[model samples]
Target chain A: MKTDQEGAVRSDALLSSWKQTPTRQAIVDYVDRALQEGGAEYVPPSERVAVFDNDGTLWCEKPMPPELGFILQRLAEMAEQDPSLRTRQPWQAARDKDYAWLGDVITKHYHGDDSDVRVLMGGILQAFAGMSVDAYAEIADRFLRTTPHPTLGRQLWRCTYLPMVELLRYLEANGFTTYIASGGDRDFMRPVTEELYGIPAERIIGTTAGLRYQDDDTGGSVVYQAEMEVFDDGPTKPVRIWSRVGRRPVVAGGNSNGDIQMLRYAGQPSRPGLRLLVLHDDEEREFNYTAGAETSLEQARAQDWTVVSIKNDWATVFADEV
Target chain B: MKTDQEGAVRSDALLSSWKQTPTRQAIVDYVDRALQEGGAEYVPPSERVAVFDNDGTLWCEKPMPPELGFILQRLAEMAEQDPSLRTRQPWQAARDKDYAWLGDVITKHYHGDDSDVRVLMGGILQAFAGMSVDAYAEIADRFLRTTPHPTLGRQLWRCTYLPMVELLRYLEANGFTTYIASGGDRDFMRPVTEELYGIPAERIIGTTAGLRYQDDDTGGSVVYQAEMEVFDDGPTKPVRIWSRVGRRPVVAGGNSNGDIQMLRYAGQPSRPGLRLLVLHDDEEREFNYTAGAETSLEQARAQDWTVVSIKNDWATVFADEV
Candidate 1:
């Protein structure tokens, strides 16, 4: 509500929850310039589309993504219910908490044949495919409430980056239609996205499986199928964005090479756009390993994107209560 | 800007552009009751989702869908450039404006193997594959500006229903997030949806083709592919709605059997919902044929849904200027 020297409302106050750093300043300046009524870069409120990558950009993805942890836990529960699942490949690995095997599977997913990844993803999806969406949401909610982060010793949902939460609010206040474009399962993210980041389920675009519609003695419901519909990673990110959002985003934020295509799509030469990369370099507050982020970091430097170093730029990482 | 009897702001003034009829009154009352603070049926702003079927609900689709017309025109243009295309089955049918062949193709699409439909859609998509989204949008805009409705003697874009336009604005003013869920091509609708309706491109969901991302000497762009990713009709409508919108709509409006599943999805037994069917029974203002909509009308009566009679309920169909 504060006004500037020319009696225009200043936007920096909206980001008071964010630390005063070069990275935050750049975002405020860019938003201000883009919102100025008569400025060359001024984009109308309707056209202010901003997309953010979920896992590493908005929340902690250090030891592993929280969804992976949930999937493993769910697999273990299923194994306990059905003893036969304990003998299965992916379920056995998950039940035993075999990080090496899981890591090998993930590596094979990225470098080796896609069938390996498909097997893992397919098994995970098949585990809970027949449940109603409401029931699945309840399971996610229960997991989020009871499970603690491996290293942070807090609830998994509470481990979200405080600065990014404030950034989402700040952009929304400036009339930017924000969306979460993630590689995570769409249903998995929907249960907590609104509560955590003020993003509704519809505003979330993610990897998905096909769904089947049914109306029998149990009444009508849509059931999730084990079939993978859209992978929604790397180049497919931009394609899904185009398919669902139908507009090229004016701003994009990410922290991995999986988001390179989305970032490049947002930062097109024909229009003014902003690309932000969040760097995890604070070992004290968060993890500091960048094993898979080398290409992303190189591209950020080469393209002169706004790089937010957690150690230097964030006054806080997780909320105090969290 | 007007106030009601209790000195509270009333949103009905926003719909003054609409006709004063029982159908309009029903919608206004329903919205007002649902939005009342202490009402039993009160819905939060974030959960106020309203979805509409585009082709027949929002605009005129008499002789055929306007997109079909546009596709035929494009096919004829291609036939001129490539002489060999004149002998191609789908292309030749479109080029010659052979209604019998086109009707057979459409009937086969609905009843025959999916691959038959795929062949037709693939050809239509391939006709414009590799074109940049912006360039394709320009082509849609040019076609919309130049082409007139065969019977109406006005531009196709000008043939939209006025009452429905007011309803879209009214719902939006009441904090409902409006989405157009159509069976039309996704890319074809994006160019004109924003200008025609207040809804933005991101809120529009429809059938889509695959896209490819490439960065060559001419800079970076996403190109359309000759692939049919989703055929959003009938049962597929609800599936796509669940896939993209995530939330089931509280209000749904449509005009044909293709929208039956979507309307049923919206009118779930667990929640308070509205299902509206626009009956094309007006011979003077619009077409009077219900060749394919008999099932929808019967379902509307059986389900006790709101049946909007165009002849009796609408004071105006299209704008006077149009």
Candidate 2:
């Protein structure tokens, strides 16, 4: 329904934060083919699902994922209440500001070592054990808005990648339903996704803690329990994608080993799938490292998946930079 | 904003299946206020969520639920493969044409007696354990379209209440996101909801079987496991509503004891909420019984929830009949 002039204006707005590169052309071409009604690669609007990873692909995850920073405050408080907790890992790492041990948890996870990740998860689970969903949301919302990204110097939300956010807008405007399928807690990202990514709370498909609905004197409330339901990462990402959306995504974006399954699941030789693996190789503007993204990078080369170089594909790193 | 003439036309189109009764007036009043942009009862379109119980509330659930009938065929095959299984309760009940025993399971569940219901659950879980979700959906879609309701003399999809589908269409046209929160399996209802209720697969929140995303040589797929992650009934209805939708519904509809919590969850005292309880009291056109809805009817009276009488409020029962 768009005129050629109108379509060009729309394309310019979508491509504003990206340099003219094969990566942008590939993404736009895949989406355009999917939108071409009655064409070979055309998908129905109902099936035009697009999913993304939150921490690294959407924002900077250098010092730590923003969620770990939010829970680090909780860990510090827990260690204060019980001094014995100071001797344990994650809690000890938080208390002493041992950034290396904290960062190693993620790096170890990608390197097929989840021992430290499990220890960090143990502390994280007990941090918000019996809080109401609404109460936990308030804390997460405040932390996301008020605190700075550990090294980025911007408020946590403002550090989101400008090009990725524009792609979300572009896809949504073209009838693709976007979802955040992160290993981060669902309630943790839900309160701010609407403001940061233009994706609403319900569209968020992330790791979930167990919940219980109890009737109280003042109506009722659904509260979070201590149990972990689905840890949506690695092989589990595709599972959550299908479980939540009920369709295979035509497009998926991610940045590490945890994303390989989802990236592979997105595009097929027969189906119109655009798999974008964001490579954080820009040290000047943002943190640069491939410690956790080694396998993902290798697979991108072998599989011909689009590798979005932060230094090459994107002209602006953070939304605030634009 | 609609002109008065346009509004009148829309109202007439929405109300065609309903009779002019106090129940219709109650529903219309709640919706009109929700659509009133600056009114006290007005809700933002983002928060205008409406949830419904699919079995009895949206369609005829008498002569046992349609899902029970679908699974009975599965039970029959199981019984035939192992003749000893024929002696068991549900298998025996299904094989012997003992509809009373099949119906009593639901009646017993609503009456706070879950003995037979548990027996039925054991059979249902093992029925289609390791099939892919897409394969299960195909079976469900065929069964739903080809099978006739026991007494309704129409395809199972055609037996859905005309008035309820109109309500779903009307709500969607008014910018409300509608969902089906049922005790039925999520996959079973997902294949048919879009065609039957105008609701989508992603919008279905129901009892979930365990699933895994398995990668084969030809990419990967999500397959169903022989486990029920969340049996969405009773108090857990509100739990799934929060887990999937992440927002309290402003409007809800139901017909059984399983739906009581969700109906109560909708429409808080401060926020705008309208709860509708459909009472199946018509015998000549449709089967009538209060065995499963006793507490629901009592609570509807005590809690001041609107009770929609099938005999009085609806001008038509089925779309096929209309």
Candidate 3:
């Protein structure tokens, strides 16, 4: 973190991941004007909210999303206990190590198809049922920090996009409260958000497992019930954001159609809304696929939103590389 | 707000509401130790959470809760349009100005009787359904700011207990983020919390009307649906607290059986927990009835929690009285 003449903190080291392109300049420019005391783009410190999508926007989702990586291991163990579970899918797919079926479930969800997503949620609810929130959070924290990505040969947390990490720090330095609004499980993301992205547990807005509070001779604790209360994708994103933050985000970042509602809700015609749409077009540097991001990509182009080309904008894809 | 010799902030005027009793001393002692750097009770900035119940704890719930006041008015308006609605419960009670029936329903709910609570909820769901969040917030804000208390004759916001208002400011000066956790509707409480108390819209946790987000050529907006997703009371208060803050609160204040689980959830056995149970024993200055608070008073005696006597401890009841 470096300080400018105005004493506003700037992160030259953090910003090094992005190339000096127009896309990078636009991000800096929006934040710069927001900091101007009486400038037209100036937003009060309290109103500066930035929401980022987790799965494919801030981190890698190829081969599989990291949460799926965590969930699959749990599902496989559960299937091993009850072999009859192998007859149904996502349990069967997990037991067989079928990435294609798991990946398809996610893609189908982005395309507004929830049939496979429901099947996957059924396995998810069973995999973690009755586990205390603290216990599950501890296990997830350990998994994210220790377990290697399936194809990336790196720890799950290390797969986070270096450029977006810089943007979070920059926004935070500029007085914006950053939040993770994603389709991933809230508990799954919260345990690792601060370590991976500088966001705290309370700022994570995501789909959640049904929670039941229990009291006994001992103290009270919350447990995961075998129910997916809300999927928190598509239409549910805006509702979660408003309920959690009580303000519309001035900026939104996304890579999939699941974030369409959030991206659309970002800015008014007169207000400053900066949307960054990450395009995974670099096959060599990182996994590249547009299956889940097709509509997001098309809308980004049509609306003249910032289409961030991974191959063109980012000088380094991962912090480890930089 | 004032600063002490050590340059730490304090509020002499706010504290003037409370008499210099041991109960007030205990409140100050807990905050002092929490602010003492490197001391045993010192808490970091982020984890200092204080949850307060709204209706009875923070303000006067007498003559019925303020939200019930707002809902009753709406119910009466709706009944005028459809006379058939007068046949059923809550609407019938509201339409008739039968304060006896309305007050009995609240008291029965505290004794673990939710039958009447359900009827009241049915009225609440229909009263504000199909209204956009912004539209509903505006109406609630106006009602809370303008409506006079039925018996006290004070404006709704000024009905807040003066001593608790001081505690909110004192805690805020010392870096605690206060929240309102109640059985009242989240949207209904949010609009008036900041002006009435020092808390913000995001920090108000309560039962919610189901929310649906709509998008069109203009933009996206969220509307309240008629469904009551979860009645945020009793066992559910802890669930709502955990879901909202992702941490157990250090301090809690309440005045009824509805807040038992929340007060119980305040502090862990090993951690610092300060529970304040307000005893409404002052009929001269305020309403005096222990009907709904029967169990809370019993538990306060058994557990040795701070039993705040409005008649004995308060130097003043309302801020305007000063």
Highest lDDT: give the candidate number: 2
Q: Given candidate 2, what's the lDDT at residue B58?
A: 91
Per-residue accuracy of model 2 over B120-171 as CA lDDT, tens digit each? 8878778887788879899899998888887777878788999999988888
Q: Tens digits of per-residue lDDT for model 3 on B6-108?
A: 2133745447788989988788777777677666666667778999988878999887889988999989888878899887888888888788888888878
Q: What DockQ does candidate 2 have relative to the true complex?
A: 0.65
Candidate with the greatest TM-score versus the true structure: 2
- TM per candidate: 0.93, 0.94, 0.93
Q: State each model's CA lDDT, in order.
A: 0.79, 0.84, 0.84
Please provide, for model 2 over A263-282, each residue's C-alpha lDDT reduced to its tens digit, 9 standing for 90 to 100: 88885556768899999889
* Chain B TM, every candidate: 0.91, 0.95, 0.94
Measured against the true chain A, the candidates' chain A TM-scores are: 0.92, 0.95, 0.94
Worst 10 residues of 2 chain A by lDDT: A1-10
Candidates 1 and 3 compared by lDDT, better number: 3
- RMSD from true fold, candidate 3: 3.6
